[model samples]
Target: MLHPALLDRLCKTYDGRKILDDISVSLAPGSINALLGPNGAGKTTLIGCLLGLLVPDSGAVRIWGENADKLSPETRCRIGFVPQTMTGLTWFRVQELKDYLSAFRNQPDGAEDRRWADWAALDPKARISTLSGGERQRLAIVLALRFSPDLIILDEPVASLDPMARHDFIALLSETVQRRETTALISSHIISDLERICDRFLVMKKGRLIGDLSAEVFAGEIRRLAIWPDTALGLEVLADLPDGSVWVRGWRPELDARNLPVLAGDMEAYFLALTR
Candidate 1:
């Protein structure tokens, strides 16, 4: 059986303000999970805490039943993390930089360069300063995956990549993770891309977990209703929708309605009931 990547009631704060509040979720081995939220929704903070870059005020983080902080260097070797920012590297050629970082993974003598080059899809002879933003981002991913870690955490990894590059990178990442049976936790606002790659999703609002749903649920359950209120009755009907799901859109209404498919219990009238 695959092990569970655990985060048990984790909480983090900065300057007396809570960033993560009792956040708890798990990623199963060989699964891809998407972390999503609006700006300032604590996605970055959560990543920092998970990577041991920031200590939480309370709670524990573990992977495959091993506490992250308690893990020794060797155990820590099984984790890979890539931040949003491209790690600045204007000093070395692409090949030189890959060779340099690959050493830390202890790959066999000549194999390091080969593996890095293959994974990055970049010419080792290319200079870092001359590489485009997409190439640099690819190198960063190569550095993260160089060790063949059991778990990969990426923050907005495709943000800088061009459309084609982003598509290619995602395909490569998906294949690599599945082939290696590696668990991945990806945080990005690109819902469309995530919908394509993620098996599960975590939604945050106001620094707290608001929704936890699988990819299917996200697509099937949540709905955007393009409503036209042509009459007073329609206005009253629109007002009847459940709280939080109701909103006025000029001459129409665009609502996020759930508990769909069934459409039971006075679908149109139920909306009027709420609006009234």
Candidate 2:
């Protein structure tokens, strides 16, 4: 209801293969949402459909109550995107690249320091081509966030980053998006990272939207229950609790719930259960 950009019954096919089949979702503004799936689950294709980059076989993707394919130039400029792989930044210095991107904007940008310059901790004077992968990715993120776009679509932006860089990127993203009230639609296979940051979860499996859960539902409705070690429990019990319930048995023998009964505190178990 919060100004949702809707994708209604989207279907796509390439060579008779349904990459996205009847996928539908509503993305709300001013929140961080995760589009999570494994390889070939159509995350990128779905993003393409949402951005109007690919024409779907049927259905519609609307942004701000208008079709995504027909968004005004102003509306287009207000959307920031960071692809899984970067290009173009390699040819210019960091500062030059920043300046180049800024010139295209018709309106004044949001706060410079808060947008990215301060926390990204990159040398603007460094040659982008010579920078390390982490540094390059950081710079790319800075560019994507520099203009304070209304909607941000990041496609596996952190998959190639190092551990420290990943942590830094997550922190930087959290700070900037929350402060600027940006709506982020992030696609990533990293469950741990997504679990830590995203307020809502949208799960796709085999080109279908299998799950949608709000942050409140995640915290209140889902639960992690443990079974006693000595007592025998089977997967049969999990079939009765909930639709997406996951049960682990004989994994850990020391915890209060040694059998790890119907754990749902994290998204990993649930996601694995659903996708498998």
Give Cα-based local distance difference scores for all models.
0.69, 0.76
All candidates: CA RMSD (Å)? 8.1, 5.6
Query: Which TM-score value belongs to model 1?
Result: 0.76
lDDT of 2 by residue, 187-247 (tens): 9888899888898999888888877887666665554455422345332222122443444
1-276 per-residue lDDT for model 1 (tens digits): 636467779898888888899999888888899887778889998887777777788898876666766766766677888878775777898768766776666563345335555656887788888888778888888777777788899999989888887786788778877887889999875667776778887877657876576766434443323343335523322232443333222222232233222222322232233223
Prediction-by-prediction clash tally: 6, 0
- Clash pairs (backbone) in predicted model 2: none
The estimated TM-scores of all candidates read 0.76, 0.82
How well does candidate 1 score on lDDT at residue 200? 85
Candidate 2: regions farther than 4 A off: 1-4, 106-110, 113-115, 224-265
Q: Candidate 2 has what TM-score?
A: 0.82
